[model samples]
Target chain A: MPTVKFTQALKRFFPGLQNMQAGGKTLAAILDEMEGHFPGIRRYLLDEQGRLRKHVNIFIDGALIKDKTHLTDPFNDNSEIYILQALSGG
Target chain B: MKTTLLLGTRKGFIAYEYRHGAWQSANLSFEGQPVSIAYADPRNGTWWAALDHGHWGVKLHRSRDRGRNWQEVAAPAYPEGAEVKDGQPASTRYIWSMAHGGIQYPSRLWAGTDPGGLFVSEDEGNSFELVTSLWDHPSRKEFWMGGGRDLPGIHSIVVDPRNENHVHIGISCAGVFETTDAGKTWNVRNHGLRANFLPDPSTDVGHDPHILVAAPGNPDHLWQQNHCGIFRSVNGARQWEDVGQPGGPAWFGFAIAVADDNPLQAWVAPANSDETRTAINGALCICRTDDGGRSWQEQRHGLPQSNCFDIVYRHALTSSGHGVAFGTTTGNLFFSPDKGEHWQVVNNYLPMIHSVQFAD
Candidate 1:
């Protein structure tokens, strides 16, 4: 299992959001797991095209995920996943 | 008379109520979010805020109790296999315009979006599905492209009051489209519209209609502040006639509001040409035409006439009853109680105003 974390700003949308353990071997699977924890959260992270939203960034064990469009970046069982919204715009 | 001015701005969705003979802020929601459009469904008193989240993408929320509380609804999404162009997946980038179906259908709602897609909801906006007929129109791929936004957007949706099945939508770089059988089939209505930027200024498509508004009294009457100029159509957009003043301030404005009683009467907040979007000659003025675009009277009383750079967006100007109001890029909200004769400041400071609509 991997520990998943999210930006605090996400709590405004998904009030039940919190640090949780998700079982997955890839970033995409982990996001899917997080979506299970907070229904309708996947859209906040990914667009309708299933690509990582332009302003969303996902980190696997403190390193930026390499695959955004495909979401194929793999992770370890003990990896700490951090889903963060990029700070941009006025 | 419409007494509430609903504003969707860069900062949030705000409501300014007209009470005690003066306009004052009444409610505020989505405090720091960019609300692209704030809509009050005339069929029912539901307040909808189309939020353009920089990070989370477009989201929709409706308040049944007039902004006291809100519930997020499913935003329109581009269906699978949909594409802006070959190999380019389509998605709803922005909810630019929204309209209630008509007096006939209480549950029906329509949304026009960026990437040139129209969506409809029938179950009181609980969910929405894309209207594919207009999306599959032949000219869409060949003619539609970015105008004011990075992608072509459907900025206006006008539902015929007589027939909820009939709708006219305005798209930047794509001209006007009318669907008489609801969303079943669409016909291009750009016969006399001129797209100067295109190689053929008189083309049947590839025109930019900044905003399209239909006269409530005459569903056949339509007014558009096009990218090239202002135009009016008397026969349900069958043939548009350019009514823009060649060398006057009424030529290059973004917003136009036609009077409810008289389709001939209208108002426009003029800006400089496409090259310069600021107030004309650094002077903010409102132009009104009472005789069916034959002549326009410029109104500047109680308005800043010097060193002002305010520009009114397409959806920021609205006309209802005897009230006319508009919000500017510089956060100035002006209201005229008796048409365009006089202007008064409702707010001199607010966020970049995106949309304004009056409610009863």
Candidate 2:
């Protein structure tokens, strides 16, 4: 199971998720589990056409995983996942 | 207990003085408005500030005797409809950056604006003349206007001490630009830079470069913080190499600085990227690269961890003879005494600090 966390800024969009834990061995599984639990969380993470949004950030551990379109990075049973809203102001 | 820290807020300008050990603010707006770029010149006993009143264009103000009295200079006019009149002036175009250079030439003043341009004033801040090289650059048409545009339009323009004509400007969507003929002709010396986020990933990775610093001791060498990572150019941007590669932390900050005593010694702030935001190890930390940016080490001793909102603006990170000072977006000013080995908070709870400068 991967521990997925939502940043405080995302609380306004996804009003239901305080915290979530999903069972998965890959990055996509974690996001799928999140969308399954929260009704519209995936839409904010992904575009209408299913591309990663321009300002959303998904991190595995501390360093950024560069597969923007697909969350195919291999995950361990104890991996920590973080979905954060990026700083967008000029 | 007169606090000398000038606070340039989003709404207006305030002068903060440290009385006892706490910080307090005094609104310095002349017409009860906000100031964008402000610098107090002790040499002439005049405080110069650029005001943004939304499409009123950029109006310059001068205060004699340190913010006690003020007078507004005539705002620069556009060439009629050839230039869009931001009727309000407060929102559309803003005076982004200001620098006072020229050792022998009576304290020259330079100001930058949105829509990408530079203006120079010879007689202090009383008047200004637009520098046309960047305004008329070959690729000026393709320059992106808003969102990720805040200081990119001529954000960093530093004149080399050894040679004045050897000037440099940091452009948005483009890499470092240099002019040897005094801004007459230009060259986009972006070799070895990463342009990996555009439709053509190879060519679009170099947009929105933040800080471009030319070491005063060695004008030939320069350091920069780009949208992708940090870079150093040994031959005045003729060639650049990624200095943030050695350190695993991603380089995603708007501020960079080089040691005044040692040109090779540099500092860059690495924040979480738009694609991957991680606060665990990647939130608001300074990376010191002793051997240039070939490698880096994190500098976080007294800084915050959870809401570590330190998004530095252009010219916000500055070095003095004794220490370094940088203002954070969270309205806090931090100073590092031992060359960024440790940090300390000088003042907290300030408005969004757009820029900061030391007085002469």
Candidate 3:
């Protein structure tokens, strides 16, 4: 199991989410698992093309994810993933 | 009747209830989120809040028991690779405004989004589909961003009470558009208006209308608070007539409201133009017109007399019967229970007020 943490910005919309140890091997899998717990969260994190939204960012164990299109970043059993929205808007 | 004032602000949403001549305010919900519009559909007792998350994206929240609890709903999004008639992919930047359908179509809702797009939800506000006919219109390319960051948006949705199929939408720099057969088709209705920013100054489609409203009594009589001036259309939006410049010195403001009983009577808060979008001479006064738009008078009783620089957004001003309400950018909320003759400050400070609506 990998630990997933959502930032305060994302938590504003999904109040039930904070930090959870979800079962997943990749970042995409983790997002799917999170979506299962909280529906409609994936649409905000990813666009209609299944790509990470331009303003959304994902970091696996303090390393920024490189594959935004496929989100193929692997995770270990003790990995910590952080998801956040990048600096945007006035 | 219980008068409820829903204020959408930059930091969240606030609900102020007026009962028996007193006001009660509630703490913020969706705290720190930029709420563009907070609307209560009295037809179904459903309250919809449009949140503009700066970084994440736009979202919609619904509450069944007023603002006690809320649940997230599917926000409008353009389909992947969906392009406009000008070959540009439609995008959803933010939801600026939302309007409920006519009584005949209870479950239907219309949403105006930033980047100049319209969305229709057949299942109330649970889900929405983009109005591609308006999005893919050939004149969409002519629409440009007026004062906001994104492209001009359909910020105003006026649904005719008599006919559910007749709808009118107002875009920032794109002018006014109306459709008789619902969202199946739309036509630009910006005739006899001026766009001072353009080379021609009177282009049909490039005019920026800050707000478009139709009185409940006369749905065919439409009033607009435009970027350049004010206008009125008595013939169902086919043509507009300039009725602003002759009545006031400053014709630049976003908010406009019409009396429920009279279509000829309206209220507008005029701000100084020339890059200073503030109350003229620091005197915040609301202009009222009783004879359609032929003449106007300043109504400043109990309002800020001096040192006021707040600007009202398009949806911030609304009316319910004889009562009129408006919220300013500086978080000042004013209400006039008897039309626009006098005013009372409901709340002085909260966050920058984005919208003010009477949730009866």
Candidate 4:
């Protein structure tokens, strides 16, 4: 199981959302597991094409994810995944 | 009766209520997101807010009990494996504008989005389906991005008051389009509009209409604030006639608003047309036309008279039964309780105002 953490900015919409342990071997699998707990959450994280949005950044174990389109970042049992929105606006 | 001003800003949404000769404010809903459009439907007491999360795509939220509580709805998303057509993107960027779907269909709502698409929701704003006829049109290839982001956007939606199926949409860099048979088909309605940025300035498809508004009293009359000039279509958009160049200021602006009762009266915030798009002469004033944009008058009673560089966006200006209200890029909101004659600043400081609408 890998632990996934959401930023405070995302918690504003999902108040009950919190850091949780999920069973997944890849970043996309982890997001899918998270979406099971919080329906419609995946839409905010990924686009319609299942590609990572331009303003979203994901890091696994202090390392940035390499694949944005496929989201194939590998995760282990104790991996820590952090999801944050890039600060960009007018 | 009370008037509520819903201010959508670059940061969040603000709700201001004016009653009893005073004003009350509440920083309600979408605390840290860019709200592109906030519409309050008095017909069904439903409030809709379109939040553009830079990283998270777009989200649509609806509140039945005003802004006290909200529930997220299904925002417009292309079908899985949807093919990109005519250089249009495959995903929806943002919901730029939303309008109620006429009196005939109280439960219907129309939404315009970036990447130049139209969506409709028959059960209020809960769920939306893209209008594919307009999206797959061959003329969409002529559309291009203007001053906005990467793709062109449908920033204005006008539904005919008499018929719910008769709809009109205004796009940036694509001009105006109308459909008589609902979303089954669409046709270019940009006749007599100019596209000065292109090699052929008279092209029908590449013109940029900043804003398109229809007078509630007379649905046949349409007013447009274009990139080249301001125009009025008295014959239901069959043809447009330039009405702002001879007497109006600069003739380049983003916002255009028309009164609910008077089809011939309208207002626009004039800005310099060159590189720097700011208030003319550093003076902030709203130009008005009483004879359907033929002649103009400047109204700046309480507005900044000099050194003002604020620019109003297309969706930022709105007119309701109460009066007209508009916000600036400088984060200032102004209101005119007595039509467009006198003005008063509602709030001088907020996040950069993106859209302003009156919730009657």
Q: What TM-score do all the candidates reach, one by one?
A: 0.99, 0.69, 0.91, 0.95
Give candidate 3's total backbone clashes. Answer: 0
lDDT of 3 by residue, B161-202 (tens): 889899998888788899999999888888888889888887
For model 2, the docking class works out as incorrect
Q: For chain B alone, what TM-score does every candidate structure achieve against the true structure?
A: 0.99, 0.83, 0.95, 0.95
Instruction: Rank candidates, TM-score, best first.
Output: 1, 4, 3, 2
lDDT of 1 by residue, B285-336 (tens): 9999998788999989889988899999999999888889999998999999
Clashing pairs in 1: none
lDDT of model 1, residue A10: 96
Q: Candidate 3: where is the Cα deviation over 4 Å? A: A1-3, A8-26, A49-51, A66-80, A87-90, B26-28, B83-90, B142-147
TM-score (chain A only) for the predictions, listed in order:
0.93, 0.87, 0.93, 0.94
Worst 10 residues of 1 chain A by lDDT: A23-32
Winner by DockQ = 1
On TM-score, the stronger of 2 and 3 is 3
What's the CA error at residue B178 for candidate 4, in Å?
A: 0.7
Model 1 chain B lDDT-worst window of ten: B134-143
lDDT of 4 by residue, B1-360 (tens): 237889888888789988776557964778778899988876777888899888788998888887898888999888765544543337888888888887778878888888777888898777888888987888775445554546778888888878878988888878889999888988889899988888988886888888999998998999999888999999889999998766347388999988887899898988888479898889888888889877888889999988899989888887886588899999989888877689988888788898998776
lDDT of 2 by residue, B1-360 (tens): 113556566556666554565444543664334567767754564677777543123467788867887776644332322231223111125677766655545557777666566677777767666676666665655543333564235577778777666778776656677787666787777777776566654462245567788876687889888777888888988888787753356377777888877788877766667464333253567778778766688877887776554667656776655466677666678777677777888777666677665444
What does DockQ give for each predicted structure? Answer: 0.82, 0.01, 0.47, 0.73
- Alpha carbon deviation, residue B316, candidate 3 (Å): 0.8
Every candidate's lDDT: 0.91, 0.65, 0.84, 0.84
Across all models, the iRMS values in order are: 0.8, 14.6, 2.3, 1.5
